[model samples]
Structures are given as C-alpha cells and as structure tokens.
Target: MAYLADTYIRFPIKVRNASGVRIWDLDGKEYIDTFMGIGVLLFGHNHPNVIRAMKEKMERYVHLSNFFLDEDAEYVARRLISETGKGGKVFFTNSGAESIECALKVIEKFRKRNRRKGKIVSFVKNFHGRTLGALRITGFERIRIPFIEHDTEVVFLPYNASEVEVFMKAETVDAVFLEVIHGSGGLNMIPGEVVEVIKFYQKKHNFLLVADEVQSGLGRTGKFYGYQHFDLDPDIVTIAKGIGGGLPLGACLMLGELADIFETGEHGSTFAPNPVALAAGRVILQMITAELLEHVTNIGKAFKEIFSQFGTVRGLGLMRGVELEKRVTKEEFLSEGLLVNIVGEKTIRFLLPLNVSNDELDEIAERFSRVLKV
Candidate 1:
C-alpha cells in the first residue's frame, strides 16, 4: 500500500533510480523510460553534467527572489535568446503554466498598446498548461469543460491549413497560439503548409504568433525548437519542461518589439530564476549541440521504421507516436511491464529520451509487438 494522495493512479512501478534511457523500480525491475518524465528528461535521467552543475550551484545558492538578478539566469537567458535568432528577450518563470501566463501578459499588453480588442486564436486539440488563462486557451474539451467559466472571447478552429486562414480572416485576433508538434493532443503533427498559412496571415493581419514549445523544444523534436521544423519564426515562444534539465523552470521568449510592451512590475515569479535550475539548464543546453541533434534525428528515423510495423507513426525527432490499430486496447497491453503512454484511445506515444540506445529501442519494439499481437 502506498501513502500518497490519490490524485494520480499509481502505476505498478515505484521508481527507485533512473539513468540514461532507463529507470528501476524499488522491486529491482528495470524499464526503458520512453516517456522520459513526460518529456522533461530531454538529456535523459540524472545526466552527469547536469548533476554536477546543479550540485555546484547548490553550494552557491538555490532560491533567490526575482528582485536580484542572478548570473546563472542571465547566462541561460542569453543562450536562449541567441538560439531564437529574433533578437528576443526572455522572462524566466518556474513552470509551463507560469510561462504561458507571461506570454498572455505580453499579448494583452501588446493589444492594449495598439488599442485593439482582438481575440486569441487557438486550435481544436491544443494543450497549453492548466492555469486559468492557459486553460482558457487550451484546445482539449475534456480538460477545458470544467473551467469553461474562466475562458472567454477565445476562438477555436480546426488544426488544418485552410481553416486557420479562414478563422484568422473572420475574427479580429490578437494572437494565434499553437504547438508546432502537438504533444498531449496525441503527438499530432501540424502540416507544413499550415505553417506557411500562419506566417502569411500574420503578415497580413499583424496578429502575434505564439508557439508553445514546452514539450517539443530543447532537442525533443530533432531541433532546438519544434518551430524550426516548419521554418517558422514566431513572435513569441513559451518554453519549459526540458529547459531546466529535470528541474522546475520555464521561460517566455519574445521579440524585442513585443517584449518592450511589458514594463516594470508587469510580471514576475518569486523563484523564477532559481540559480540551481538555471545552472542545470545551461549544462543541458550546451550538451544539445549539432551532434546530439543528429543522434536524435537518427533515433527518430529508427522509431519510424520500428513503429511502422504497428501502424501509422506520427511526429518528428524524439517526440513521436505509434498509433495502434482499433483492435488494440491500451489496458490490455499494460501487463507487458513497459511504460508507454496511450493518447486519443489508439496512439501509443513515445516521448523517448534524446539519448535512447538502439538496443533499448529494439527491446521496446519487440515488447510492443508482442503485446500488440496478444
């Protein structure tokens, strides 16, 4: 019997320790961690460099209020902004939801400054964070139904290229927030043409384009940012999950023009730029160089080849999904001792760690094939 809140259904596995591409339960059973802590362990569990950075920063300080600027935070911010290539500034926060909140503030302030009462356009199956404002913009009905009261003036459109243009043209929207590769929405991939459509509409209407890269960034999708796949340059980008090397950290990156709208006291978090988290983030980002990205791409190709035997494979890089046929049920497959995530009733999503080995991939595929046959 476990002694914790019943908020989450306890899996049979009680994790004791985790390392690259694998986790061990207290019972001494090991499993390949394809889910990768819901896409947080981008560099895999307890990477040595990340661990060393965290420990070194812990000796200096852990949590300093946002009042004082920390050097670690500045270092991370500089690196992130440089990667964006848009001369954007960054605002640090502690979680994905907080980062969304920061993005919301930026959008609202931008609209207010322009004297426009425009709506925020989101998609039909998008998943932003769970805060009130973020939830309002989120696209999943099951998650949004309970909190419908908090959402207003938000327009939802189909995740298709034609529909996006039609929606933007018809509605006076201030911004359009999307996930370049939809993670919680069942590892859905946005069409490349749809991205071109978004860019075209943004140029025509001057609405802000926001990409939620919380799950798809930091080499998760073969690129530093998922938007890179679509050749997109979003006006604002929200990042978290993998940014802090398994710590609680998030960041909102915006172009200098859009960032200027948020004046002093506009937004802040108490533990936003925690030194320990930023230190780890720095190491993780450094490790995600050209060679590591190539590794991710190669692994993604292998995932495609293996998952194709099951059914259709969707998504890019380490963020991918294997959609089992209607004949396969997720409940029936749980007895196989592997921890795969089922979304949208049929898709078995693999948020595989960036460094997952080919041998581990082979094992996962064999186990999955065996379970699928059963």
Candidate 2:
C-alpha cells in the first residue's frame, strides 16, 4: 500500500504463491523471482524448513510478550552469536529498521552515560532503515531531507578512504555506521584502502562502530557479516531482512562490555522475540551453514562471470547489481518477465535467494541475456 501512507512504489502484479525461486501471480503467470520480497526471503518463498519451523512454533505458541520467556529465543540468539561472533547480547525487533533503532539507542545511551559527544557518522548511499534514528543515519539526501530529526546529530561523508581517515580523527563522533557493500547505492563495494582505514581506526577511536548488515548479512554476501570481509569487527551489528526467512524478526547485537549498558527498563518491544519468528530464524541459521556458504561463493563467482558479458556486475554473492547497457531499461526487463529491480538509472539489481539452486541461477542469467539481446 504505497498510496496508503506514501511508503512504497506500487506494482501491478498481485502475487498468489511461490516455491524455491519462482513466483506466480493471481492469473497463474510464473516468473523466476530474485527480488525475494526486497531481500527478506534469502531462502526463497515458502521454504519448507522455515515454513515447518514457523508452523510448529505456531502450533505450540506465538507471542509471549517480553515479560515471559520463549525457549526458541535462546537457540536463535546462540546461533546469531556463533554465526557472526558479535552478538554478545542481542535485542530482538520486528524489522531491520527497529534493529537499527535499538543499536542507535544503545550507542546513544553509551555516549550519554560517559559524557561523550553525540554525533553519528555514516557513509553516503548507505540505508539503515526508516525509523527516526535510522532515517537520520541514512545517507541518501532525497528521502532524508524532508523528514529530518532536529535533535539528532549526524555527519555525512563520501564513501572513500581519504574522507574516512579525516573523519575518524574527529573526537566528536559517537558512532560510525558502515555498509560494506552499498546495496541501494548502485551496489558499490568499499575499497580495500577504506576498509584498512576503518580497521586501523576502530582500535584508535573509542567511538562505537555499527555495521548495517540488514541487506548484506545472513550469508547473502558469501560471508556471515559483510564487515567480516573488511576485517572489521563492529561494536554493534543490526540484522533483519533474511533472518526471519519471511517472518518479521530482527536483532541488534552488542558486543563486549558495550553489551551491558542498558538497564532493565531502558528498552523493549512487546511483540519482539516472538516464538514463531525465532523458530524460523533458528532454521535459517542452520540452513546457511559452512557447506552452503561455500556454495554461495562459488555460484556468485560464476554468476558474476556470466553477468559481466551483459553489463557490470557490482556486488557480492547473491546481493548483486547488473548495470545494463544504455540500450536496456528496467521497464524493459519487467516486460520481459525478469523479476529483478532497477536500482539507480543503469543498474538492474539481483536480490536473488541465498539457497536458490544452480539451475535457477542459470535461468536468471539466460533471461538477462535475453533482455540484452532483445
């Protein structure tokens, strides 16, 4: 309902059902889906394991409020910690935006408690979420201009090594939010020099580092956390999108002593840590294991080789953007039955599933070739 609150871009097709990497519309027209509900379904639509986990949880119980305990939460939390090795303590949320909200609060509280300066430095083109705090840190000026939060202090800088080095030298910074691969910003990857600067400065500075892995995490990037590729361990990590396997679940993982700042009454969500979503999360974590990670890396490499013949492929693993030649347009791809998105002017994005088979990947590549040829 983009019109309902002016929240999203409206589409014509009304989806009915899906399995693996294919989706069907109400009239029974089928297409290979890589949009995957904007990257939430990393395991693809109606994944049997995830569905079964949620179903079993539903049969047992659903929401148990924050006051009561849910057994599945422990399993999910443990898995997150083991996967990323950063979630010393985790706060559950309903979406990635909420996870960002929680991370912002944690760092904000940490700064306030220590009497430090309060400024958030984030790169241009990196999107955290839509919540007030997350919105402030979001880099794109188009969407952020009208909804500016007056009280929050945020600094925007170019995603380059020189700019980052200069900014890290500032004492006024409280936290730095980084997205390793610029998902919405035309799938730009961070340069090695910039990654080095951040890694070195992460030690010299006391400012908290928050990795916005909402789109790039959960084995979508061939690594559990995108920042892992940078050799940078963030103080707080926000995860969502694919974590719930299609359900609305997310987490803000805090590490070390920074994990214990919030007192009992400082933060919470009533419906968060829901048993059903946690069950699905547990299953997804299990699904994206060592063997699966290796498969994703190998497949991603092959897809990049194939897509390079079409245009520039500019992202990691399943999170990719195919920059089409001037002859092709996003509208043309949509008309051709390809389900990828047009991000920026020249790029056709691939929000492909993490668990999509090799055959599905080949089919997607073949269709893109068709888009270019026709």
Candidate 3:
C-alpha cells in the first residue's frame, strides 16, 4: 500500500542504512554505492563532519526565516562566490529545481530592465530541473510535452551545433543556459568547440551565460564548477546535489552587474537557507579542498580505465558513464552487490564519492567487472 506519487521508478531493495560508499538493504545485503545518492553525497553517506554540524545546529535551531540575518547561510554563500573568483551574490534554495527557477527569474528581470530581447537558447538533452520555468528550458520533449507552454521563448540547439553562432548573429538573445556536463543526458560533456563558439559570440552580444552545475558542481567533476574545465565565463551558476552532504540545499550565484539584479521583494523561499542544511553545507564546502579535488581527478582516471574495458566511456572526474557492449539491468548489478545508476538502455552512470579511497576503488572495480563477467 504505497501512498507516494508515481513520479519515480524506484529500485526494489529497501535501504536500511548507508555509510560512506556502502549501503545495507533490509535483508542485510551490503552493496557498493556508485550512484552516491544521484551524485549528492560527495563526501559519501553520513559524513562525520556534516552530521556533526547538522546535529550541533539542530540543538540551537532548525529553521530560520528570510527576514533575519543568518551567519551559517552567509558563510556558505561567501564560500560559493569565492570559489567562482567573481564578485557575486547568492540566493539559496531547497533543491536544484528551485535554484534554476531563481536563475530564470533573475535573468528575465535583468534582461527586461536592460531592454534586451527575451528569447533564451538552451541545448538539446540538457536537463535544468523539473519546475515550470526550468522545464521550459529543459531539452527533453517527452517529459516537457505535458507542461511546457507553446509560446515559451527558447531555442533548443544540439550540443555541438554550429547553428548557435548562426542563430545568435541573426537574433538578439537574453540568455543561454548550459549544463557544462550534461548529467541526466547520459553524462555527456559539452564539446570544446561549442564552448568556443558560445564564448566568442557572448563577447560580442553580451548575452548572459548561465552554467547549470546542479549535478556536476562541488567537486563532482574534480573542479569547483564543471564550467571551469573550459575557457568560458558564466554570469549565473546554479548548484546543488553535493553542497548539503545529502540534505536539501541549492544556490543561484549571480555575478557582476547581475549580482544585485533582484529587488527587495522580487523573490524569496520559505524553507531555503535552513539552519541545519546551511551548517552541513558550510562543512561540505570546506571539505572540498585542493587535495580532495586532486584525488577525484586521479581516482576518476582509474575508474575510466576500468569502465573502458566494459565499453565506450564518457565524462570527467567521478561523473562517468559507460555504454556497455551488452545490455544489463539495475537488478543484475544489485545481484553483483553494486548499486549503480542506469541511463537510457545501456549506459551505466558511475558517480563515486569524492573521498573514495584507492582500496575502495579496487573493490568497486572487482565487483563491477564481475557483473559484466570481465
């Protein structure tokens, strides 16, 4: 008698507990968690520092209103802005969809105030979020067909289309949304040439570039933000998934002139900047140190080598995908004592934890290889 909505196709196993990159089912079977809570648990499950921070904050207070000043939230916002190395302001949200919603509203307001065009350009197969505004720009038509308005002023371009430069040269655009690494789009990275085209046109037209780093930010791709991997600068960055150490926390970082685009009453969230979540976010941000990023890069390389043996591999850092030669189901992988995310028909997306050690990596490889009989 399940009462939940039919929104998710959940795995069959009932998860009882998790620690680090391991999960134990109700029947007491242990499994390696390569999915890492859909790329949320960067430091892995029940991270000691994150748990401690939340516990301490919970004792003092759990919720705070937007009217009051919040030190924990301020500290997190400052750290996020500093990571981008840009002058910016932050609007906190409870999830990635809310962050995208914030970015969309801000972009619209900024463009309208400046008398710029309202049309936006987004890429095909790149997912922003599930909210109405975010879904309007999301590239998947099947999911968007029901809710998306017919008159939504957005143009969807292929990931590496030359049409971007062609279209921009002819029409003025207000903003361009990009998922530096398309997490839900089978972990496909934005091609380098496409970035060059976007950057060149951006300099001339001065259109706002928004980096949707909801899944690839906060050390998931061995960088603070996935956009940093290339030579592109973004005006607004939306982030979530990893910053709260499994709790709900998302942010829209507005840079330069757009930093102060929002007025006093423009936007607000009731549950955003939750004291407990902010406390956890502060600790998670601090833990994403240079050494941790370096570890992700090196370990990610090793993971690629292992997955490449299975089939074609794509993506960067710990955010990897393997299109295997043979089709395998999630249940089969579960039988092999591994929990991984399956994308489309044949691709397996592996989003390992940032702190996963060499020994743990070896264990995961052994289990994964057994699943494919390699």
Give the per-residue lDDT of model 3 (tens digit) for 172-195. 888999998778888888888889
Top-lDDT candidate index: 3
Question: What are the lDDT scores of the predictions, listed in order?
Answer: 0.84, 0.83, 0.88
Query: lDDT per residue, candidate 1, 166-275, as tens digits?
Result: 87777788889988777888788888778888888888888888989999988888888899888887888899998888889999998858857677887777777788
User: lDDT at 284 for candidate 2?
Assistant: 89
Q: Which ten-residue region of model 1 has the weakest summed lDDT?
A: 327-336
Cα TM-score of candidate 2: 0.95
Best by TM-score: 3
> Candidate 1 at residue 65, lDDT?
91
RMSD in angstroms, candidate 3?
1.2
Off by over 4 Å in 2: 1-3, 149-152, 327-329
* Shift in Å, residue 329, candidate 1: 5.5
Number of the candidate with higher TM-score, 1 or 3: 3
lDDT of 2: 0.83
Clashes of 3: 0
Ordered list by TM-score, greatest first: 3, 2, 1
Better of 1 and 3 by lDDT: 3
